[model samples]
Target: MKNIFDKKITNEIIKRIDTLTPETQANWGKMSVSQMFAHCCVTYEMIYTEKHPKPNGFVKMMLKLFVKNKVVSESSYPKNGRTAPQFIISDEREFGTEKKRLVDYIIKTQELGEQYFDGKESHSFGKLSSTEWNNSFYKHLDHHLTQFGV
Candidate 1:
């Protein structure tokens, strides 16, 4: 997995994001380009803000057990795989707005660096090592950006 904390990798990811446009269509999945941007932002939102509710204890445990491995692993996601409810974006979104937010969040995560996330508590998964955090963050963005053919 690529290191999200590395400045070069972060800039490369931003370049991929910059290639997207309002009219970009997914190679699979139901999301519009803007909705995909919002969906990608959900991960960062969970990390940096209190906008989304943390899962209850039982739910968190289930996620950690059943979902954590897949999310934090180095494997690529299957096309149009099931997503968490929090990540579903059914409504319309402003393309430029969501794109900017996603870019900003990526920059913030990179700036914070690996040490800051060494044992960070995730929204759904429990505390994770920096490698796990980097894998989760980079993989998701890579998956979606690739989905839109960027």
Candidate 2:
């Protein structure tokens, strides 16, 4: 997995995001460009904001047992795979706003650097290594960006 904390890789990802426009169409899947952008932002929001409610004890346990490995491992998500409920963006969103918010979150994550995430407790999973954190962030962004053919 590419390290999102690396300046060069972060810049490359941001450039890919810049390629997206309101009129961009998905290569597959149902999301419009704006909804896709908002969906992508949910990951960062889980880390940096309290916008989504945390899963309860049983749900958290299930996530760690059944979902953590696939999510944090250095593996690409299968196309059209299931997404968590918090990540489902059903309604239309402002393309420009969602795009800008995503870019800002990427910038914030990069600026914070890997040290900030080293051994950090994830919202769903327990403590994660920096490598796991990198994989989770980079892989998700890459998947969605590729979805839009950026």
Candidate 3:
């Protein structure tokens, strides 16, 4: 897996994002380009903002037990795979606004670097290593960016 904390890789991801436009069509899935951007932002939102409510004790335990590996591992997500409820962006979004937010989040994460995130408490999965954080961030963005054929 590529290290998202690396400047070069981060720039590459940003470049891929720059290619997206409002009318960009998904290669698969039901999300519009704008919705995809907003959906992608949910990951960072969970980390950097208190926008989404944290899962309760049982749900958190379930997520850590059953979902953590699938998320933090290097494996690419299956196309149109199930999205967590917090990540579902059913309503429309402004393409530029969402895209900028995603890009800003990526830049901020990269800027903070791995050390800042080492042993950080994740919103759902409790504490994780820097590697787990990188994998989760990069993999999700890559999946959705690829979905839009970027």
CA lDDT of each candidate? Answer: 0.94, 0.93, 0.94
- What is the per-residue lDDT of model 1 for residues 40-129, given as tens digits with 9 covering 90 to 100? 999999998999999999999999999999999999999989999999999999999999999999999999999999999999998999
lDDT of 2 at 123: 95
Candidate 3 TM-score over all chains jointly: 0.98
Each candidate: RMSD: 0.6, 0.8, 0.7
- After the best TM-score superposition of candidate 1, give how far the Cα of residue 123 lies from its true spot, in angstroms: 0.8
lDDT digits (tens) for residues 1-150 of candidate 3: 999999999999999999988988999999999999899899999998999999999999999999999999999999979989989999999988998898999999999999999999999999999999999999999999999888
In candidate 3, which residue pairs clash? none
TM-score of each: 0.98, 0.97, 0.98
lDDT of 2 by residue, 38-120 (tens): 99999999998999998999999999999999999988899999999899999999989998999899989999989999999
Superior by lDDT: candidate 1 or candidate 3: 1
Looking at model 3, residue 119 earns an lDDT score of: 100
